[model samples]
Target: VAVSVSATASHPIPSTLWGQMFEDISSGDGGLYAELLQNRAFQQVTPNTTAALNAWHPVNGATLSVVADTVPVSSALPNSLQVVIPAGKTGPVGVGNEGYWGIKVTAGSTYTASFHYRFPTASAFKGSITVGLQTAIGHSLVSTPVPITAASTAWAQVNVTLRPTASASSTANNFTITLDGAAASGQTVHFALFSLFPPTFKNRPNGMRVDIATTLAEMGPSFFRLPGGNNLVSETVAQRWQWNATVGPLLSRPGRVGDWGYINTDGLGLMDYLNWCEDVGMEAIMAVWSGFALGGTSVAEASLGPYIQQAIDQINFVIGDPAKSSAAALRASLGHAAPFPLTYVEVGNEDFFASSTYTYRWHDFVTALQAEFPNIHFIATSNTFNPILSPNPLQYDVHVYQTPTWFAQNSFFYDGFERNATTYFEGEYAAISTNSSDIFGSPATGRLTFPTMQSSSGEAAFMTGLERNADIVFSASYAPLLNHVANSQWTPNLVSFDAGAVYPSTSYYVQKLFSLNRGDEYLPSTLPNPTGTLFWSVVRKTSTRQIIIKISNTVGTAAPVTFVLPFRTVASTGTAQVYLFPFTTVHDFDVWIPNRC
Candidate 1:
């Protein structure tokens, strides 16, 4: 390939070009959020069955049942685990929770354990409650006794720390809270809002899992599209993600049923996301629940007034004056006196599913939101110019899922877009299948369980075009950023994890390479054949006085190529860094070539 090093810079590369998109498809509460105990709060749970107490079980012959307490621990949590110790029981008897899949116990690590408890009626039981981390076979790894002196009917919280002396051999472990059966015979106690957290990512309370968060941080992302993808919308308007219900103390934040059919603890709420953005040094691409749902329901235009107001309040909570808006006041009360930095507010997620009604919905929302916060950019999530949105959307979020070959062919997808004031955010894109006819079908139909080398290379080729047209494409991100290995609804995520280990896919490294080595200016170079298996992009870092060239080879066989620099002073001994992905292997290897001209 011949590089036009003498040519002027074509366009400046966007800083927001590479980032991540997050939603809870069993990825939160149990995946990224550090809390280990699953189904801890019993939010939106029906009492009195094994299914209701999904993760909790009786220990040492103690009878366990989930009960609806009249005098609940908090209004946000109405259900609690009712434990009855039989009169003849002698050893420790209470309840144990099998964490999301299993609990990982590490030696020399301290864990924070807490729970709320109350007696249904007055009792003379004065024994201390024991919290322990144990193996699946009931062998205690660590235990601590927290004495409870209050015998009143009112609820009380117990906070204790468990320092494990030894790590369990496997992730098949459990967190247990028990009482001495002899000391409190026939006593019935109700427990609510139990939490057990290992050392978090940054040691922030209710923070993210250390391993998973560190992996994402290594990518050097510029933005985070959060509170998730289709997980933002629901089957009905009433069930959509509510910003108000996701902020403040966990005791006050009533959890909801996520679009993925699991009870979201709301432990990782709006404030948490903003904090994550700040910690990671990234901007927030916040999405509001537009008046549409995934189940083909759109709120009437007349009814949109309230929903629009809700969106306004949501925005205010992020970047409003506490003296004026109540939502901002709430934000201040939660200790974020200063407004969170926000630039892009996505109106909805993938509204192309309900494009027929998005015309007015887009008009009503954008018209109101723009009036309130004119500085913020609002992104429309519908087909471009299809069903035509009013006020002419300044930005559009485009999503695509296709085969590897399809992605490579669509490298020039954005080259044909009109060069106007309008921009694009390729919000979600992935090579999910090998079969063109059944891209969204099952694994038997060639769907990928994890991203392969061919798929990653294909995505890299398309990203070159995105960089080539940087002036038109403002930002882009890989969707469904995380997935729980044992409990995943979506296949081929960027990162996958179990309770103990994290697995980053090939696509992850491709994103990392581009993001970490991003240059300030795009360099015009000799283009590859339009219908070839090898493609490349060239960019220049003005500050470092270095050039970055990215190449992707989709086939297994090596295709040799050479570069010719047109610069007046070419370096005869510069280094060449290559990230090679062989088609047959899932792993990537790095090759460093020194003294290369």
Candidate 2:
């Protein structure tokens, strides 16, 4: 492509255009979600050491029995595990928790372990309890003991600090708590709502995983679209992502069937996402549950009033007056007294498939949200019935998942969008390289396409078009920010990880480059006889007086290019920096590469 520059600024790009999307599918608490213990509340049934003991196992030849909570912590979670130690047979009797896959520990690092426990009747013996990080076979890595000298009928929480002298960076470890004493036959101690966490992102209680949060912050995203993809509304309306079901105490959160084919321990719920935004200094773009399920079922138009009202209540809960109602007060009780800074509340996700009912549902939600949040902006999904009635003018979500060829061909796709008709949010998009087809399902069968150099280059080219059309495009973000290699539900995620390590994909670098170098204004440049495969965009940062030029060579071979400056007089000693990505073939993707590599 031949390029020429002139002293003309065509359009000023919105600084908020480039951001990130975090869904809950592949990233549960065990993945990117910060809750350390998997099935901590024993809500998700798993085949393990005990019934309903998904990741927990009994230690020292003791049989741990799972039962309905005689002393319930909350109505949300009603199951608890009971450990029965006979009078003379056991060295130590308790449960070991397999956190996520395994609890990752660094040498000499401190972790917090806590759990709620109660004795059935008054225990005849005062058994001292020990809790720490350990291996599956009962090798303690970070052991600490806290004596339970007195038996209590009421449920009480015990806390302990553990510092491991050895490095279990393998992330293949567990949290074990054992009662090391003799007890009368059938004397039982019940355990409920156990948790073990490494150092958090901001050191807040019930906080986020530091590694995952740090990776996101480094991307310099301006906004975060939260509560996820198809997981926003599950296969059934009964299991949708509801803010009320996932707040306050961790034990109280009733886990649900994940839309992505597992269990969703809603440990990182509404407040967690909001607090993460505050921690990373990004704006919140909350996606509420629309009245439709992924199973091709939607609520009737007349029945949408309650869902709309719920949406309003959710907004109130986020930016509501705390003294106004009980729900608003509950938000304050969750530790965020001042209202969160929320501007965008998406009505439904991917309502385009709803066909005839989508328009009415969109209309119902827009009408209700506008009545309550007069100043707030609402984004319409791609399947909007009529964008003309939208509260936020022309704000419609545009999602694209395609191959490199498609991305290169559609460089001018958004240019033709009727300027005054509809504004756009490139909410979810990625280039699916044909080389690697690994996703979230069977290891033999691929899920989402893995990120490759070919794909990243294609995405970069597509982003150029997005930048060129910023006048109509309001904001854009990449989809499915995380994937756990062991149990992923989707692939080609921006970042991938296992129990031990987290790494960004080739596409992640492209996103980081564009986001970090975001400019203040778009400059008008021309490609005379532009080639089909080469894509480029030019912008100027008015504050720094620097012109940023981004170019993508999507073709297999390299092509020579030149830039002509718009300035009358150019600096002789000016510093110049160019970013060039190496060509990666489709077959080059390996999920286990280190993040920094």
Candidate 3:
């Protein structure tokens, strides 16, 4: 609790509190006010999850599979594979709703298809498992069906060998591996941990595709957040993002249940995400499946080894070299014969829901990860846990979702936080909705419209809170970026784009504009809550020594404040670049003007 001090007759107001609010600062209240300026007294959250598949470098891809057995609600997994080998039926194992299936290859090229599987009983079918790769003529073939004869019950493995057709070596080929009649026989067929490759993606080898390659290049985004929301963990630890189950060939491994409301294609495995990030020049921030999943389930202290080891393997795959170890050998087969650089390893996402559950994991992962790689920084999902100062160093990841006015009103929310050396990460803070504004409207509307964009005044006030104390906030970013309006569980992404196009919302420009224009160092100034009808803030860039005044008029009127510069330090004088938000608006492409979906 903070010691309170109020406006009393003896309350000494310093003649000039620029150096320090010395007169009032000495009182505990001054220190309380100082808390606002500290970076953060706890952990820091960065952004969203980013993971992909690389036929070359298979890490978590081998342990997990994002399957799609139904209509994709979001970026769930690939579409379900259909049998019957109809002449033109085998298209893609279909991920992202993109019809590109597994890779097509050359004749005599030794290829392996490995996938994870869990059958209730091996005796149930006692038959060969069916798997296929679609052909160029739009026809599907069940060419690589491996026989599952001698195997244990429950969690099991299946592998199939296939030599590429005379067609091509690097072109796209559709590969689909499915448990033949397990499900039909009323047998529970579970698939997780699967993959397929020719010993070459990781440890630094080539693994990329022209189609996906094209999509990524166009986004031209500076960062890539993967693993996405909910997919990292399920309603329980049983549903955690298992990284080891996703590598190897497409057979042997069976894909698992996906939290994205469907089975995952596992198509976009761990290595895939990293490769995507690498291909797109995105710095990967690997977020471990924080203990808390959607519903109520997490890793108990006794059963965390698998979880902990998975973290180690994830780090190893990202930084390990190519050689003979099981993991390294797998990488060689995938396509990558090299290592991808890893800097940040986040422990969880939005664990505020399960502070008790996440606290243990967050604390454990931080210590273990830090001890293994001293150079790496750990980001925790909870803002209350700071591994750095708690006999250990940790950053509290912060996230806020609110209306622009709420943001404007809470601009000073961090003011009373602690002043420890511990830091913070503004991992995710964006206004969003999973719905497109089309509401039951026709298909002619554009994209969905949410109240995401607002005047710079609110941003300025918020950014000032950050800049005045940049020491705490190491970095920050908005979440649910790149939402395909047609299907999104989370809406109003930072930068929305499609196969052939990209659109930067007003919020995107706001981030680009402020973050780029800010000065080297920040000088502080104060704003009294005048009229209590506006949000105001100012920051003095150290290098340029220019003070940027940001004011947001929430009272439906231009509530202006007198401009004052201590040394007349205003850069170009009175008028400044002003940004505004409208009383009404929507974000839809011209063609879908009213569709809003």
Candidate 4:
């Protein structure tokens, strides 16, 4: 059944049509080995099989709602956008809603809009902001407007840059967010959010510029399962993702309306995604959707105790001990009082589409959050996996979007489950094609790829079969990490990068070459000859026998690799560290090339 046919992997110049598919390779525990180096780089930003709906401003809030329709609406603000008079929203109820906010744009793509303002610093205060090109249905495709003025009233910010002009078209299905409040009315100014940015896709920011620690060091992510998949749930229960209306000072944080049709701009909440996983090092795995929901709704089991006290106040505001109270005064008003190591939370996300996450309104919020955090670590995305929906020891969190050779022929479907020390969390997998529509609400259509890389090297050959089954795959990422490449609802994404520059994919160098060439230990032995498209995997370092090769060809063509020395007396003595991720190339987020003996 290798007889298959596919058409539109589309190519005219997808950076010079891919390359070499396969050749020589042998080694599975046979002491896995490969000594071929041909340009290797690394990066991160792959995850969006379904979960980042309206994933803007980090995850939920900081700013992003700039718009303009005009009429007393500060003449439709835009000089890259800037307007601040917020001493107190006044004069006609802050000029009713205002207008102008449809940012879908994407003609050559490279936008970066902004907004945030405040006035009255007296002899040292100034203000201004304006950006143009509207007219999808409203107006102002530049009837002249592009002012952003402000030195500092305190807020300060009004960046604007647009290149849209190849006759400029395709707003990629028109969108809107426009906002304006009649210039300094009653001179009490107070409009805090505003944004617009496209073409950063997956690295995040569709309607609000992003910079989160240089997009998490080119997404060299380690683990960030937080609020992932279904964006951590909230289609109902009166629209969730609250976390105190999404944190401070950006209009005192009050932005939610999102299941991802648009309007999230919470600038990403929960202490700005745990200080954005401590500025890009990553490791937050914070899911808490429990209490059941995809849409089936459940709090039963005699009111699953306020959904297990909102999962113990979202783990005492992420790792407790902010000092105690009001979640440690909202973590000292978001400047961080510390406390954010979080082992794992993950209560719900896929909630079994509707089977209800592990039962009883999600196993009583994971048995009252492991009975009040008894050493953390609790997960459960469920739709299938069931430890009887666990009531105690947790960790399941699976999810798939399918395709790419059925994810390289089932990549050994969990080797054979039943590990009972129970563990695994691929969380949200991908490939998504066949039209991919079904994202929770079900109807089905995805097969993955909202960004690009021939479907992220078939999701880097199923993350090289989840790093040849890391123990049993303890953690994994790649689920709606982001999407804004032209209002992209979802598609191939794994580090498209922005701001300065970034680009990774050959499926994010298959976990940046298996998380910087891992090898804690795993070497049974015996493998060689599955050469359909080279899929090597082995690890050994019991002190230092060295040896850790992880190759995944994904059959694009060029792979004349050669290796077979499990240790016939260590000849060709140590040393070899290849990390190739080519198929025309863009992979340079990690890029490491070292091979000598």
Candidate 5:
């Protein structure tokens, strides 16, 4: 194949082309958030039963029960763990939390562990509580004694640092907070809001897991679409992701039952996401709750005024004057006096599910929000031109999930779109299955366990078309960014992880290559055949005087290709860099600079 690159540029490549979409599908509570313990606050959980004490277990035969306290530690957290020491107990007796699947203890790493405790009844017991990390079979890695000066009815907090001298052999470990049975046998103590955090991404309190955050940072993403996709919607309006409920001291934040069947601590809230954006050099693509639930429930038009006002307040909390809006004041109270930078505000997630009602919902929301914040661009999440949204939305978010072959065939998906004022955000797209008939089926029905070479190549080919038509396609991102390998609800995510390690799929590397090597200008080039197996796109970075050429060969066999630079002066001896990913091991790619092109 022969290719000729033009000297002149055609269009400017969008800076927001590559980004991340986050939701808590077992991804946040156990996967990304640095907090190790699961169900730490017992948020939204009923008292009693082993299920209420999801991760906690009795230690040294101590009786443990989840109890509802009249005078709870905080109103947001009504439930607490009550541990009763046996009358004749000899060793330490209390409770142990098997952190999300298991805790990963590293050598020389300092962990901050904290919990709120109070004696249910006034007692004279004055003894120290031992908090430490232990192996599954009862071997201690590190321990610290936090002395309880006086037993009081009112709750008191204890904070301690545990530095492990040696790492655990595996992730099958647990954290324990035990009391000396001899010091005060037959005493009952209540505990609430327990937290264990290893060093975070940037040492920010309640921050993200270092290893996972670092892996995402390496991709050099431009924006983060949060708090996440379908995770934004809920079975009911009350259970939806409320911006107000997610942005305060962890004690005040009333955690909710996440769309996924698990309790969300809300420890990683709105502020956490914005801070993450800043730490990783990315902007926020924030989404607001648009009075729609995943269970086919939409708030009536009359009731939408309050929800619309809620959206306005949500936006104000991000970029509003503190004196004018209470939400902004709350943001200022949380140490971010200056408002965070925000440009795109997605109206709702996947409104295509309820497009009939979206007509009025969109009208009511945009009519009010546009008046409040005219500078911000609102993205519509429904099928384009269907339902015919009033005021003619300036932007639309498109989503697609199909087989690898479908993605390759639909490379020119945006090429046919009318060149008008309205732009597009390919909010979510992925190669989920090999069988087109059962795209959303299980693994037995051709669903991908993880992104393979064929799927990644197909995605790459489609991305070339997105770059080719940069004028209409402003941004695009893969959906369901992360998944917990052990308890995943979705298949073939960009990144997969367990309690111990992270696994970046082939699709992840493809995204990284495109994002990290993005250029300022799209250089017109010789187009590939419409029905060909190979595709390419050319872009130029004006700052570095570098020309980037991306090529994708879908077939397994090697196919030779040559490029002829149309520049007046061609460098015959200068080094040319190449990043080669063969089909055999697509996950492992090689990069080297050759002596000549």
Candidate 6:
């Protein structure tokens, strides 16, 4: 580490340096995940019984049972829940679903609830159905009753408009559907494929959860790394995220078992993600499903052609000329006629885990996708193994998950590294605290994690390294961005929320502050001692002509330091507002409240 306090000059830094990562991992209702109904299509399976109904409970004298679909219907789910209101049953008897924990309903807002149903008999069943929101104890509010004069004997969809009263509580409400006058001695109605959604982000059908999307939009991310982390390539080859399986009609999408021990609705499909990016003013950094699976299974070279072509088609659908290719035409039919802009295409996620065959696999994908989509740049998983054999990648994805002390100590990890044509993307990195109560906190039962000062200080220190080497590190994003408190798969997420409120972690603020103040050019600065206790980066904004100095002090006591900008004249009025994040105890990292800082 060399330092010359006299030489304080500025150089160039890339503007595309910081962004966010969003994945489907126990994202709360009305949070990042859009699907309100947990087991919407009833695609549940367990050891005890095949069709396992997890989140749903019987309501008002109704008996719930999962039955296999005897007859196959076009694009219908395999299993359906049978609600039996006994012949002598009194009052409204039906089923209720506690959405992803609980349904979030706003006062005076209309929610669209729909379900598919069919009768056991061939005769047209005459009945009435009421769908609405209610407390867990059966106190009802805002019920929409629809008369079913004669529904089809085959699978038919029913939709109802529900508007909660102005006084209805927005939290801890459940979405329920009740059937009346349909309980006959020999008569029974079958129901399946239930769905309930609030007004989405842009009021688009099958859209994003509004509140979650707004949160990400506020962060002002440069790009959205869509579809997932290990989720892109699951443990099983059958469960890998297939773009084709996740598009178009909802019923047609056969949701696969997610890598994180749950089912993915794919309700937030590729088009939906692109629309979200459009709404948030970010580009798409799409990750294609490479032939490698996390379970250490790589598709043999002879049969890897289809997967490579799928990646090409995904690119074609996004950026290729619509008039020329069927893939692009399909994109047009999906309502995004004009191709969305995408600069980086990641071949696979964490493929370096299988380094034995990764280079060859990378070659296969790069050779096919790069030749066709010459305009788009490609990124590899990691450079841990062999240097990329052929068709060099533009950037390499690097991931680091370590303790806060490790991150703070390694703040200068990339200092004076060889400058090469290939840049770096820290796609998934976090100062994890798996053993601390701030993060793990009774890991056996706890599902949500909070960011502590120890963790955040480490993250800030590491980010200063990225800021210092912005020319080499083109972009970076924190991993597992949003976590639903009830059913999270990963810990130390950026944001955690239940049905009621959102808690942005300490690290979230660190990332937000960095993102909001990303300077255009790097400035050289010399420290007096250059100790590990302090980490900082100096850069200048090309647009504002502001000299920004981001400093992170990890030590216990603060030391007064003075700066001398020799090359430029200093003005007292040029000082901008100082943003300081004071340190707090690790135990107090539970959540963020207004004015807590």
Each prediction's whole-model lDDT (CA): 0.87, 0.76, 0.47, 0.46, 0.88, 0.74
Q: Model 5 misses residue 384 by how many Å?
A: 1.0
Q: What TM-score goes with each of the models?
A: 0.97, 0.91, 0.55, 0.31, 0.97, 0.90
Q: For model 1, how does the per-residue alpha-carbon lDDT over 1-597 read when each residue is reduced to its tens digit?
A: 443443478899988988988888878889989999999988888888677789988889899888888988888888889999899888899899999999999999989999999888886768888899989899999999888743698999989999998989999999998899888778998899999999988888889899999999999999999887888997888789999899988888778889987888889999888888888889999999889989889998999998999999999999999999999999899888899999999999989888888988999999999999999999999988787888898899999899999888888889889998899999999999999999998899999999988898889889988888888998888867889998988888999999989999989888888898898888877777657888878888899977877878777888886666556655655555455654322334443432233
- lDDT tens digits, residues 159-230, model 5? 999999999999999999998888868988889999999999999999999989998999999999988688
Compose the digit string of candidate 4's lDDT tens values, residues 472-570. Answer: 676776655443233444555544432222344455555455555555555533332333555565565445656665555666567665554433244
Q: Clash pairs of candidate 1? A: none
In model 1, what is the error at residue 153, expressed in angstroms? 0.7
Off by over 4 Å in 4: 1-191, 197-225, 228-252, 255-286, 289-345, 348-364, 368-390, 394-418, 421-423, 426-475, 478-496, 500-502, 505-507, 511-597
Candidate 2 displacement at residue 211 in angstroms: 1.2
Question: lDDT by residue for model 6 over 139-169, one digit each (tens)?
Answer: 8877987766434567778898888775446
Q: Which candidate would rank higher by TM-score, 3 or 6?
A: 6
Clashes of 2: 4
Which RMSD does model 4 reach against the true structure?
Answer: 21.0
Question: At residue 198, what lDDT does model 6 achieve?
Answer: 78
lDDT value, residue 386 of candidate 3: 30
Model 6 accuracy (lDDT, Cα):
0.74
* Evaluation by lDDT, superior candidate among 5 and 6: 5
What is the TM-score (0 to 1) of candidate 5? 0.97
